[model samples]
Target: MELKKVIILGTTQFSVMMCSILESEGYSVYAYSTYKEYLNSNFFMGCPVFLTEDLVELMGGVENFMILNTIGYSKLNTIRERTFADLKMREYDIMTFISQKANIYTDKIGQGCIVMPGCFIGNNIVLGESNVIYTNTVLTHDISIGAYNFIGANVVIGGNVTMDTNNFVGMNSVIKNRVSVGSYSIIGCGSNVIASIKSYSVYTGNPAVHKKNILDINSVNI
Candidate 1:
C-alpha cells in the first residue's frame, strides 16, 4: 500500500486525536499550529511542528501532503475551504480523515470525506464524496447519504434514512427512521425530521416543516 504524508492544521485536542489515528494508519504527519508556545510542548514533541502562519512557505516542495483540519465547530469548514483553494492553486490533492476510535460501519465512503471523533456509523451506511460527518454524529443502520452532504455535530440519523446529494443537516438534528431527505435540502439545528423532505426545501423545528423552498432563493427550479 502507498502511504501518504499528511499536514494537520490546528493543534487542539482534536488534532492530536486525529494524528494518533493517522500515525497508526502509517501516514507521516506534520503538525501545524497558530500558537508558537503550543508547538514547543511535550504534546507536540515527536512530530514536526510548524506555525499556521507559515503554511504556504513551509509547504514548499511538499506536493503529497494532505491537510486535515482538526478545529472544532464551524471553523472546520472555513479552514477546509481555504486550504482547498490554496492546495488547488498549487495543484495538490486534498485529503480528509476519519478517527480510528470512531465506530464507522460503512461499506464504502468516497474520497474527500471527513469523519470526526466520536462518530458512530452503523451497518451498511453508504456515504458519497466530500461528505463531512462532524463529532459525535450517529448514523443508524442502512443509511444512504449522497455527495457533498454536511452532517453537523451531535446529529442522529435513524435507520434506513436516505439523504440525496448536497444536503445540509444541522447540529443536534434527529432524522427519524426511513425518512428520505431530497437533494439540496437543508435541515435546521435542533430540528426533528419525521417525514420525507422535498428537494431544495428548508425544514426546521420539531417534526420539521418547510419554512420556504430553497428554489425561491435562487429562482432555479429543482
Candidate 2:
C-alpha cells in the first residue's frame, strides 16, 4: 500500500490520540483544526496544524494524503459526517485508522473507520463508513452496522445485529444480538439495548428504552 500522509481533522483529545498512533506506526501525519487559535500556532505535537480552510493549498493534491476525521460524534454523527463529506467533495480520500493492537478478523471494514486498540471485530462483520469503534469494544460475529455510527469504548455488541445509518452507541453499553438500531438514533452511555430501536430516537437506562425522538430534540453534546 502507498503510504499516504495522514491528516487528522479537529484539535480534540481524539485527534491527539490518533496523531500519536499514526506517528508510532511510522506514518507522516499533520493536523487540521477549525479553531481560530490554531491558525497562528503553526504546529501541533511536532507536526503542522493547518486552518481547515487552507487544506487545498498545503497538500497541493489529494492523492498523496489520507484524511482522518477525528472530530468524533458531535450531535451524534453530524460533525464526523460533515467533515467526511467535505473532504470527499474536495476529492480527498478518507483514511481508516486500525490500531496494530486490535484483532480484526473481518475482511470488510468500511472507509474512514477508526478501530481503536484492544477491540475485537469478529468474522463476517460489515462495518459501514466512518464508524468509530473505540478501545476495548467487542463486536460479535455477523453484526452489520451502517454509516457514521459511533460505537463507544467498552461496548459489547452481539451477533446478527443490523443497525441502520447514523447511530451513536455510548460507552460500556451492551447490545443484544439480532437487535436493530434505526437510523439517526443515539444510545446513551452505559445503557443496554435489549430490543430493536426506532428511527430518530434516543435510548438510555439499563434496559435502554426510548427516551424521546431525535426530531423533537434539538442538539446535545455526546
Candidate 3:
C-alpha cells in the first residue's frame, strides 16, 4: 500500500521538526514554498523540496497530498494564516497535526492547528483555527483561544483564560487564570501576566503591563 503524502508549507526549523513528527505517524513528507530563502535547498530534512507552483503536479494532484503550514509565528500569525487560507482557496486538504508525544485532553481543536511535542492541552479547551502551540507548553482546562494565535514553548496558560486572535504569547510566559488577552497582542518572553491585555497591545515584565499598542511599535523582539 502507498503512504499518505504531506506537503509542509515552509522549509524553516519548524518544518524540519514537523517532518520527523509526520514521518513517525506514517505519512510521506515534503516541503515547498515560493520564498527564495526556503527554496535555496534541494531537500529539507530528507523531504524533497519543490516550488509551490509545482506541488499539485509533482504530487499527482491536490487529492494525493495533505497540507500543513509551518510558517511559525511570522507577522503576528498573519503570515501563517495567509498561507493556510491560500492552500484552502486552492482546495488543498489542509490537516491539523497533533504530536504523538503530546498529551491532549480535548477534542475542541480547530482545523489547521499544530500542537507540537511535549505540549499539554487540558480538558474542555477551545482552540480555534490555525493556532500553533509549541513544545512543552501547558494550556490548562477551560481556556478559549481564538484563531491564528502563536503560543511559544514552555508557556503556561491558566484555566478559564481567553486569548483572542492573532496574539503571540512568548516562551515561558504565564498567563494567570481567567485573564483575557485581546486580539493582536504580544506578551513578551518570561512575562507573568496577571491582568487582562487590551487589543493591539504589547505587554511585558513580571506582572505584565501595557507597553504600547502593536500599531505604534516598529519592531517586536518576540
Residue pairs with clashing backbones, model 3:
none
TM-scores, each model vs. reference: 0.66, 0.90, 0.90
Off-target runs (Cα >4 Å) in candidate 3 are 1-3, 35-38, 216-221
Report lDDT (CA) for all predictions: 0.73, 0.84, 0.85
Model 2, span 61-130: residue lDDT tens: 7776778888778787877788788778877777888998999999899988999989999999999889
Q: Give the top-scoring candidate (lDDT).
A: 3
Per-residue lDDT of 78-165 in model 3, one digit per residue for the tens? 8788877887787878889999889999999999999998999999999999999999999989999999999999999999999889
lDDT of 1 at 21: 72
Backbone-clash count (model 3): 0
lDDT of 2 at 213: 80
**Per-residue lDDT of candidate 1, residues 26-142 (tens digit):** 777865544454455524646667775555577775565667655433321334445444555655455767777689887588766788778999999998766789889999889
